[model samples]
Target: MKYYKLGIVALSSSLVLGGIAPIAYAETSIPTNVLAAKTTTSEVMDKERLIERVHELFPGMFEDVREEEFRFDSGRSYGEESELESYGLRFFKELSSDMYVSGRFSFVGENLELVYYSYNNENNEEALFPPQVSKEDAEKIAVSFLNRMTNGSDYQLADNDDELYFYDNQTLTEPVEYNFRFDKVVNDVPVPDQSIRIEVLGSGVVSYYFNELTGKQEVFEKKESLLTESEALDRLKEASNVELQYQIQYERSDDVKAVLTYLPSPKIDGIHGMTGQYYIAGELLDKLPKKEKLKVLSSTPVEKTASITKKEAKEMAEQLLMPKNDFVKLNIEGVNERENYRGQRVYDVEFMYETRNGGSGSSIEIDVDTGELIDYRGGFDERFLGEEDSSRPLAYKNALNKAVDYVEKYASSYVHEVAYPNESDNRQNRYDSDDEEYRFYFPRVKDGTIVNGNGIRVSIAGDGELLGFSIDFDQISDWPSLSEVVSKEEALKDYKDVLQTELQYVSNNNQNEYQANHYKLIYTGEMDKEVLRKYYDAQTGEWTAASSRYDSGKQPSDVTIEHPWAEEELNFMIQAGIIEVENPETFNPDAVITKGDALKVLSKSLSRYYRYERYDYEEQKRQTFKNIDTDHDLYGMIELAIDRGVLEADTENFPLDETITREELAVWYGRILKLTNVADHYEIYKLNMKDSEQVEKANVGYVALVGALEIMTPNEDGYYLPDEEVTLAQLALSNMRLAQEMAEMDIDYR
Candidate 1:
């Protein structure tokens, strides 16, 4: 699998969950060679230890040196004839009497310029060390200078002992620029050629780059012998303000001519954070309006600047096509940040981004100040994208191809395969991390329940990334890492008569219906699914299943099987009193049903006026029905059902007059019994060979009953056997089920 790290800061971290990119960091440590020879890893940790050392070595010092490294000259000096010099180079060489070379022992920094007070203070700039100061005296001078400069601010010092150490004992800091003011007492011939000889002591390490093309200074930042140049540059670049590069070209004359451009430093700037700066030649100014030249120089930062990858741009465009969110802003095009550009450590970067959803080319940004990329999320304007099919960008096409390949190869299989929307959501953002992530939800996706679905529920995660998602699944349905979901005890409560019934394996003769990434699982048990479906309906909401050859728009029928014992063993039938009670109207028939009472007909069994025993009954006016009375045959049954909230009192209750439909029985049995682990023993509706309507209505109940008993197979179109009377033979099996149930349930009724 290809791995991607998201976001600028995220590039430094490992992906955690759902591709959430954490923060990123630039360089944290200097190279080992930049520290003292004896410094250990312990000394180079978080600059805290360095602080303590600073306090001990230079108590009451002003500004603490936060970073220090030793720069060892790997090569030896040649030409010195002194026997002790070991053929070292001569200290003094003369081109003219005016030129003199003198060796002085000091830190690597002398004509050094390192930052102290971060703010711009023209008067506060000072040299890091004196040219001719000795190692010991240099430390004293450094402490004295920084102490005055920092004024006791809370600053951490740097520690570099081993990696940067040289045989010469001295610590090098960064470079600083200062003018030498000390003059010796000896007076010689007055000459303007008096020069300063500075020694880069300690490791004598310094770094500056010269342009290879022109041999001119592109930009030079020199460090003291004690500095780890790369490390120092990293720390400064982390600030949000770092840009790419800057260039200046002009004639010898002050106002001659020129073209200058500046770009944000790529190292510090992330992709899409590019900033650009440019200047016109003075020669052009002479021929053009003064205002024009000034305007060129004062071009404000672009407004809504965006630098998105191709994929992000496309996604944004797609989002626009569908309009998922009313105000979706995906790819950032261009915008200017000015007036008060607080130092928010900006990084200009360059990367390949693809825009989607509905947005222009991409949400790519080009910064004004640094001439570097600001940000680029993916988006394509509908009008722009649809101008012509072939007008689409090659980059976008490639990205789309990759996405399609991913889905085809990894997505779950189903006849109605998921495909990318031709159009995108069109959000506005720049730089969509490193990967093109998305989620395709399927409102109704089915996976067979391998085990008894006792209190079985489903859920979805990776909302915008995972495929085949749904809303009906319980939250935390398959919690992988945490105990935030239902506890094991709570989950176990739902498993009643459920068992480890051999985990019997069955093979399907048909080919796998799903894709390689998807599986079409089917579960089989002694019980039928019809009873479970009916039970679910009654348990939650009161819904009806009309034998419906076809109701909602759907395709032709699928499968069928037979069920027999639903009339008695079905949980709803027991709740409805279809099963004969053993004691005092309690249906104990070898099957365990707690008892003390229950002799009333349920409200569902009748359609007539019925008595509601409640102190506040008179105040509540209910609807009307038929065929029920206080002296009715099922009076106790109805009363018991009402008391348990299983039946609602109405104007008329249909007591004993109405024959129950199989679906109704299943729904009620599952509902009132609260049977979570109902054994799969019912049947599903199926069409006969000829799909006969008369046969469908005549034996529909038997068909449904079989399904309710988990004995029949279900097809796409429900069970069809109608008009068939339920048999006593079928009723006898319900009792056997009751016996098994009685053995497991511990709850007792009065």
Candidate 2:
């Protein structure tokens, strides 16, 4: 089995295993209470002092340490003094054993703090698989470590919705790591923006920690002066508004359902606890404007076909992104045709510019069918220009007009389906004095209701220049009718049923500034019980979580919780997002497994490309089987299996729904192991089973190979059961073993 190395090191310098660099610490002395003190002035520490501070944090971990100089600047010329020079100090050390540790220190106020640290060891062979420590135990370790830090008592553990045992490129051999985030609290209310994250390995070891709490002192609104919870809830109700939207819901089947749901308007985010006012775009408001009416860009829909050539698309991109200045030279790097998520074929044009100092580049996309510009983002750096503009920035209204004009000129063909957003729909603080750019979204309207997730986003710079533009239009043929939907008032009542609030100290300050100017006491919607946040079905007038609609097929069945045989493997597959069952609540482990379903699980285990896409199969180009066309739900997985050589496409049609046999599964595993040639020569293999004669002549080698590899085993009677129907539980255990064997052999199907 392959073990994954897990560690995080924050440094620009490379790591080299060697002895410690001798440094004299007698010249510079740091205060013992420096780390715990909250000083006002900035303090610069020497190399020796920084090393001493690191040792204090993780005592005896960095005995053989080496110091390295790490410097950085904000687009400034070389040889200039920068703030990073005083704060960013890196150190590395290799222990006498196979363990290695590295850490960095930064000056937070006048105190030196360890900003980042990583500990890794080569002898991870004994690391327990599936994690020995549970999430509950890991949380205890994280909280204990946090409480040991200065002012850590002021923080509370925040809710984490991430999977408990999953990691990127995770294998069964790697130990599990649990990550937690703790938010700082003021007056018993959480400051959502201020948080410290900690990651604990399954071995009860704190592998990583990050403290985002700034050194700058913050002032918060007095909690005593805040309005009561009931008053705040009433204010929220008055400010809240609900709208009808048609959402495309992708299920485990091929058919896509259009869900008409009552979704809350994105206008009101929170209610000020002290003033009983609505907070929109970080600004309090007495009332919100009326919802905007649909304003279609054109009366007729544009022609949708792949009519534009690569040369034509490149020319269009050059016309839009290439600046009309002679000071810089722009070159077209390449152009490629690709299908987008929405099943729209488009041309991606890549280009770059050369300036005297340096160069930057960006790409744009154009719909191949309509020959209309779909996306573009362009901005020239001011430093590369000749002189700075003396004129003032464009007003919000003027910048918006510029964006509208550009969209009308470039993407006019496809604009008929989208409607301009309401003035109140601009979720940003447009009235703010420091606001720079204006972002606008034109949502797709159908049957006089917005299609919540489909829209076009356009961004306009403060100087009235087109900064970015992108169009997202799904090929939706059927839209649910709104005639039988519940009344808006009834839907609003249903929304209020599950609506809950929590007090939080919110900050509207710029993120670049470490210190917040001030924090406001606000009551924000907190639906802690519901995973879907806030969504009400218009037809049923019932609240629903996103899992009910999208993840019903992926959720583990209750019956698999304590099964005698396949519970652990089935649960692992579900947690890893490898297998999908039709009815998760009542998944029958003993049911005969379908050929297509078994192939999907095998492909997902071996191939990285076997991913579930809502609209991916609609645009799939390969059809490995006559029955499994682009319209089939598992078309992509079948094609991926064919590509990986696990499934042969020699047959005209695949029996997707047919019951798979044990011997058939063995053949697929043989192909996955790249032993198909040896399996074909059945005479060269010997079968040591009591029912060896029952196995087919052509499948004897495959059955023998799997039994030898221990991916599959015979019964206690020494019968291979080659002709038996493969059950869900049997397949789950075999797939797990197959994955482990593939990892051991270093076979990467990806």
Candidate 3:
């Protein structure tokens, strides 16, 4: 969270979908008093007034559209000093039964200023009506919408440099939707968070979304800098300490061919702007190797040949841990051949220490065809960690020697020109902060350029024993000629002229606020990351592909539930801070849950409290509800639920005070699951439950999904028992299952 001055920009914000972090501004300084005054919520316009405003803006688009109102209980903002009022307008047109197109909007003022807008051509229309328009045609439709809304001025397509992204792999038979984005331009500079995103479905129906932009369009004078571009580039190069790597490029359509190119290593994101001072390093750590780029080799099938024997594999593994004295007895666990991802066979030999100088397990893999050690992992025991005993500690130089000996013995064919101790990998002890382990990385290089993703990682414990080690080499055989490469002087000239600097409003999560500052420029060039583009020719530069946008890491607080319906939802809600898991290890999904817990989950999941504001610890203490007071853990959520109309406002019949029935659960689920009400087709689908007739018509869809989709189940008698109370675990699991089903079914709630 520490903000860098003139260093690597981690860009704390999450990537949207493709792990591509778009350029965004945190905040620009405005007077504190003015910000405080503007933070208050204003009264929402009446439904008629809002509809009139929409009609006024579009003139004809809303003539046949139906409008509805939604109120948010608690307002929320992304950054400091920004909060939205709880009112919004939704417009829709029913194309047929179980099919429709709709748009949602939120306004800014009494004038009904348009702060947001979105449209969706729901119902999988691509199967019935394929898209007649191309990506270019969709762009025109998006532009037309923007022009009509803004009266056609001061806006243009921001991403004209790259072709519009069309996800053809999404479906094979139906036409895929094309999404186009347009950024607002004022005084010839792109406005930070102001843009329009339009989605065009196969039916040629466009769904539009407008990002809420609050500040006035003010032009500031571009200031002259004391530092030159070359100076800034030098500072950037030093800050990033980018290493030159030999990238093995591949192309496969009919035959698989490999071509190695020399260039700088890849990075997480591009450098946005350059500062004058030398920035601190390690804001971003090690660069991951690029993928082989040949997922499916249709014509070139890999041959699995078994030439090396089990004995040879064991001998090579023992050589890796050689020069062992009589006291150090090693035991060979096993040696077996296995098929890799590419359908190639290799020998996997495992071993362990059987002596007093304790260690854990270790493994080594030798290519069955080539008889070369391709991979290795050396492990250590937990006893190696803790304490700062000088008597047992190994010297840094000796540890490095042991690491080098192991690598050279097995991977002697590859050159190792790069070696650095990674300080970031050090695990500090609670008793002694100075006591730390050391991790060293040795990257292979050829013809002066380092090889990407082909290297060895060695770790030395605090007690000086080799903690762990790994060697990875993804089939990098063909090397490219470096004779045609441009000299460093020539590349530096283009780097100096093209590298631009800009004043940006930046914020690191370290501070709760943002400030206007200058930074090194970052962007994705025609080929690679903006940071590595200057290392060589644009076409030949070694670029890393973007990482996954979503973080799939597990959390410690997650409750383990066995039910397929509840596990994912329980984990998601716990991670989102929506549902509390009293016990971290287990969630009692089958046990009957109380009404207070149910309401808290519903309030968090279905209400604005989940989207905008979080549970305010201090604010909950001031709760004054007669039945549910400050002592209750769900005090804040219950209050918001009542305010937002998710629950009844009657204090006498507090939802938190009673146990919830199955029918009541259905009603609450129905409320959040659908944006607009559809006819209850309870009698249309066949009912398997014995007492299905007892289910109310209104709650049929909810109950059906819970039962049919296996989100919830009936008793041994095959009766739904609509009035039966549900457990907290059951509620979470059922909702999570429903969400998954909706996503798979392509249901559009927005």
Candidate 4:
């Protein structure tokens, strides 16, 4: 996030060398009229006008404060030139006890549109800190702050909101910060990605505030939903699935343990407004077009399977730095051989250097089969930046020349092809340095199309020395010679054909706890991991597959069960198909539930469709539990529970068939609540029973949770009867209650 690139001259020149070309269509597919309407600019505001607007916004906050205006780097670009303009301001105030606070703000134009603002206390002394404020007080402060920024506009508070986080210490000595987020509403519905956040400290002081609003609000098209909420939910549910998977419990050991459970399917945040259907979001890619594949090559190799020895890799790495005289004595740090992500065997070689001046070394990857360079990177010794005899900073052109020479000398035997630099990746560093740092990124192209992940990035310091360099060549042996078969117009048509605009209840996660549905265009094309989808591929006239869908578990066929008391509960579970009985015709409600059966139900209830990595348990069974072996029907679930710390019975004597005690069941359910992050709200209720003392102290949390939820009730004697065995019917009812609670609370199990 360094602001190094400033000069338009250098930025434009580098873009030309980077091989970027103008495209006919908008990359994001946003209509040209929409784009134009959003870019409307106003006349520039003077410093006096900006100051007046600030004073009007806040009546007394700016009194006697030192204020200044300076150029700010607005990180944005349009066409071939930089479109960033700065109208920034800074204000500083010294408090009563000599502790100082500072505030920074940015304005867009004559109307004084505030884009960014932040305030922080400079002193760390505890005595000077302000008094701790309640959550309500913080909300009031946030409202005042937002009201002033928006010039009398108002916002709403989200439910289960007012997040409070403590830093430094949990004790009274540390300060707690409360974050308040508000959204701008249009036609009684919240706008997407347009909101303001006001963070208040314990002192009720506004610490940070940002209004992420852009585009002309007046031009926004507002509409109503064409589909109901139930329809959208159904679509997502049909396409999505919850899976069970084992992850190492990071809170404890690094050793393999299948303790944690997670869902593989991505959940929908809300439905889109325009497209009244369920849609995923791209928070990652935004609306960029998805490339089919990245073309990566290291020239035409002499052989398809040429072997590269460790010694050869070391030598090739050293050659990349030959042109630079800074590296004096170099030693091979380490060399490792492994298959890369593309299934190509490669050698990773690291080299450290004793510089003649003050530079560092290189880490390079070489393709083992073709003896070609995959990537090379090295860091510069920063001490050289301050030295009097350090090399003079090179001009932008000279730096590009050096970078090209380095790549040509060490990368490949074929002519180096330069792909255009990605607009998002292009930036100039401008902080903590004497000169501007220019960065250039170029994809290695073959057969016209730039490969997806194959590229070279070179950064040149103001001193003309290489700041850093990197190259990614996947060693693609063959590439399609001709461009995509489909025409650009055809691809555009395809994109529109598959695009879906849905009425979704979008929550910016700031305001509107009761999310209102908004119409938004959703790409119906293939999505990757989340909601963001890939754009239609011009060559194929089809949207690229974001990723292949996974198969969750399937349910068993319907069966009749006759246990009257547990009939409803059993049927519900059977419909969910997470837990199944061997004999579907009868569910023995009065049967004593064994530890193995209980755990199997719990594990499957949480994550039924999840695939688990099976391990040989012959040794574990012989050394610990004899009742459950590797061949046991419920071995996977029981073992998973044991590894996850849900059950911690004596390993040597696992009573798989023995009826589980009520106390033990409480401990198991308690562990589940903790693992699933269902808050333990157990302190409010008091148990008034003589047998309460019989409940083990370790199982108290579990008992309290179940009791509070009425999942477990006392007997006529008002006794919990902690050690008594529970029947299958009772456990099923409790499990059902807990499942319902999880859904209602919206607790994330994955």
Candidate 5:
């Protein structure tokens, strides 16, 4: 989140209350057509004429303040309603430059009121006081109050994080409108740049926002808000229990009003509670030439949209307002909130539902503005079972019980909600990084509300643990499941097809003849004992597998496996760092290495060792392979190797699928290395005059390779037998060494 390449901009709501008043017009001057007769070019006269024109359009509608018969001189107002006609207002007088004196005024038939918006900063937002502290004392006391009383004792900078600074104190002028936003740098160093503030909450968070560049508004999502299911609930609970507080720290000019629209509102139900008041904002402008929020506001009722039956539009908005999960149902009744998108008023929707999953079904959450899919739980429960079993979604009680017990022991206080019989699928065979394994979701206990945010995921249906869990430590959740991106069935199909072409193979994870779905998606490299050992030793993730012995488990999915390749170069790459060799003990040999992965290895190899004076042509290199191109990032680097004659290709093309071996690579390297060498490394070798009978007579080139590197030798079988195909791991290890020798920088542009 340092640079937040995955910028989540959002749109939010603003309170523009009520029906439009008729615009007033006056006619004291002649029309523009009549004015055309004037020959005078007086600047002062022009200004007068413009004023007249404006008055003719919206006369008496003062530009100074906008409210129905109400003046906005001080830029502040406070009051809220629980229902219609239940209105109240709070007015304030300047108590000091830093504070204002305000009174809670309500019209409950005559001056009846409640003391709210009293003296207190965020974290104390809900701090209510007795009637004694009049609007005067509240505003006066607030101005003199120190922030140390409110912020945490060990307050650390959310901005410029390494620097230990916290909210020592801050004062908010009435809600003000700012034209732009500012940004912070590498260490969260504050930098004044163009950014629109939908609403600023406290010092470090914005309620809603839109990237000026992309025009996408992502609401309620604060910077780095992602967290584990556990962390998410924990935050929500705390927020609900107490009134939240925040401040705006950036510098703004006197002409600009600093209105912070974002304040996380915490609500509570009888025993359980959910406490996250997020925001939805409008879209931003193009190309951030200035630091500011979007200027356009929509009040128009769409003509086309209006043409649709109001019922249909209402239904669209209702569904959009809720998360799309089949397990939960929703009943929405829209209220006249404030303003709408086209020409209608945005509805204040009231809803309720039941979680069919039988657990504490949380809210049917949806995106604030454009209701889009986020997360869901209810109605349905799933777990791994035999592929051909007649029964499905079976209720496995014992396993669910154990998992909850395990979680409660290590993480009861922060635990959100535990899913029973979570579903899992492996999709690495199609989209590697998008591989999702488990469907288990956990919640964070916040203010008693078990809200889902972030957590660890494991597949209990089998012995395997897809991953131990962790989450970003904030209100947001991480993108744990890639089920949507890579099609699981498709990836497995690809895996089956590749391995089927190989000689007779055995699918080892499950008992004899297990099906493909039972494989439980895994990284191709996870099979290596060294890598697996390291994975567990480092405690990098949770340690569970479908079967510990790999020979006794039972499942019904169809899967075909082939033995690992024997190529030394490939094996070296795996060891050195260029590629992964196995997902488990099995290696599906016939599987075609992806064009993306192939270039990744080669580019990674070159990237480690050398920095070219210039990057080779990006466009041209992609043209080197018939099956690949420069449009792909690998294009330039691959072409660079080819043009330098450092790569070997058949006549006109580089066959991307063929496996490479050590001897072949070494032989190839011998020629390239000699271009700068004073004497040929091949000089020490004599054709057919074998040093060891195991050396193939047909491999004089390999003999020369062995002499040049001097790393390997004849083994117990007495063979340097050079023609064997290389494994991905071997290729990785060699490339890693090459990279180390080159000593390239590891910083990434992204």
Candidate 6:
């Protein structure tokens, strides 16, 4: 067995048998001979106290340990070096040759506090199956352990959908663990940045824990001087504006439609209730500057065809991304063709910077057909230059101009389709001050309306050099008519009617440094409420929720609770997102299911590709049946079934809407089990049942296999009703049984 080092820490001292070595310390706390003489007694006592704390947390697990030296620079300077005793410390112990436990602690004033802890028992055989504790019990253990922390009383359990310990599709061989997040609140107002995350294993052990709580003091806005809720809403309404745009409805179909939406303005994030001013990145602004539109870079159209060779594309990349320093050269690694997110074929050129360390590299993507620069991100890090210069950085306006110039030089053929950037597009607060890079987004325009899903993003470094560029344009031919849409006023009114707000303490500029940052009390929409998060559909004059695989409150109806047989299986399928419930109140499980609906559920439950989004460009255009075109609702699922050999396109047009029979289901199950050859030879199998003659001769082997495997059983009277129509409930129960048998047989359909 090979032992692995877990973190990026320097090895300074040898492994100690009983306890940590006296000289073992973090790099930031390294002491010279003179400094050691002055602080030896105090430092030794602090180290002993921290070691005792670790032993108390994980008793008897870390006796034989080694110290790893790491640097923790908070970017704050103390007056003198002798004033600060230590900064951070890390220690690990080998439980076995291949398993270990580690803990990281930081010095807070006079005491050492644990910042992170982990137990590397992920591959242990004992943790793989048959979880000893339930998720509810594990959650209780987590909460009990959290209450012993220093700031435990200030935190509350976070309400999110990520708290599930196991998913329906998860295999039984995978380890079971519960994850919980607790958010720190100030005077009952939740702070988004300060939180603690804890992971509890199946054995009810706290396996990992990390906290983002800071030590620095902070100032918060006074709530006593705030305005009323109605007053804040009025200010938000005054600042909000509606715009007409083209939104691609990918969930329904690949169709672009004109929509009048009231999207939250990028200039304003929230309203400050204290002063009735707009909050833009935590700064109060009396009013926003006038919005400006970007002018088209070119007026001429370019041909969309393969005009350049592979060698020419490589040459273009070298010409555009060549470094300024002669010693550092751009080495072309290789080139490959792949489909981008928008289903466009492009050539990805990967290259590396031949620097001293020999690891930093980036890639550039170009359109193979039009030979346009689709994506490129190249810049020189300060460390790569072997020296640092104290030169001043370029102004924001100068950097913007440099970015525009680079785009025009490399992507002029496609630049005419995108609108140019304005002043508000500058993302100054999103990056660090030392490595600040300005990003600008230019939206694509269609018939004078912006395309929400299509845009071009450009990033320029502080030294006026191109850092990154990418274009996201889809080939859409049909667009809805804009003349018949509702007015912008009506759309805005509809949004305001459903909008609701709650007060919370938010960090300035959305920074994660909670202790050193300032916060303000603001009224904003509750993100957890789905009804308040929808947009008004201008064409239909109705509100439509965001596209998701499953909607909130879309569980099986109350009628399922009284189900005599398939209550659990029906609820499981619905919760797993395999079966969509159109009407949660009236989900009649007894209704007969069509061939298309049955195939959809089976394909999604067995194949991982059908459940998730596929970016394979070739599969996007392929069709298996004549009736199930690319535009059909069940095209992808049907194709997945055909590919998996569960169904075949033996006929030109499949009867998608026809009701399925019991014999048909058995045939599908037999194919899934890879017994097709045996099932095809029906003459070799004999059926012994009351209605044995009712089974077709061609389906005798299929029915025999399903009955023997217990995937689908006969009726109470031992009568095989092969010609009866299968109901939704009957399919649900049988599919689950088939899945269990597949797992037992070690057959991985996914």
- The best candidate by lDDT is 2
* Residues 347-415, model 1: lDDT tens digits: 222222233443333222333333222233333222333332333222434444443443332222221
CA displacement after TM-score superposition, residue 407 of candidate 4 (Å):
18
TM-score of 6: 0.73
Per-residue C-alpha lDDT of model 5 across residues 549-642, encoded as one tens digit per residue: 1121111212333335434334333433334444635654344344345556655444432111123353122366776553444455566566
User: lDDT per model, in order?
Assistant: 0.25, 0.65, 0.48, 0.50, 0.29, 0.63
- Candidate 6 whole-model C-alpha lDDT, 0 to 1: 0.63
Ranking by TM-score: 2, 6, 4, 3, 5, 1
Best by TM-score: 2
lDDT of 6 by residue, 1-750 (tens): 101221111011012111211222222232221122222332344455656666676677666563232212222112232233334445545454433445444433454444455554423444433456777888888788778654457888886453431222433323455788888788777776677778787667777776664444567777787777788877877777666677644443354333444454554666876887777655678887566664766666555445566798899888877877766878889888777646667888898888656657878898888787888877556555656656666776787677778767666766677777656544432334445676777778776677776778777776767778887676776677888788878877766665555677876643333325577887764433445435557787686764322323232222333468888667656645567777766878898999988887776566543222442423557767889886576776677677768888799987988999998999998887666665677786777578889988888888887776777768899888888999989988888767655544334454
TM-score list, all predictions: 0.15, 0.79, 0.36, 0.36, 0.25, 0.73
Evaluate model 1: give its lDDT: 0.25
How well is each residue in 538-611 modelled by candidate 2, as lDDT tens digits?
88877654422223333322233446888877776665556555566687778898998887766665554312
- Model 6, position 500, has a per-residue lDDT of 59
Candidate 6 clashes between residue pairs 3 or more apart in a chain or in different chains:
none
| lDDT measured at residue 223 in model 3 versus the true structure, 0 to 100 | 33
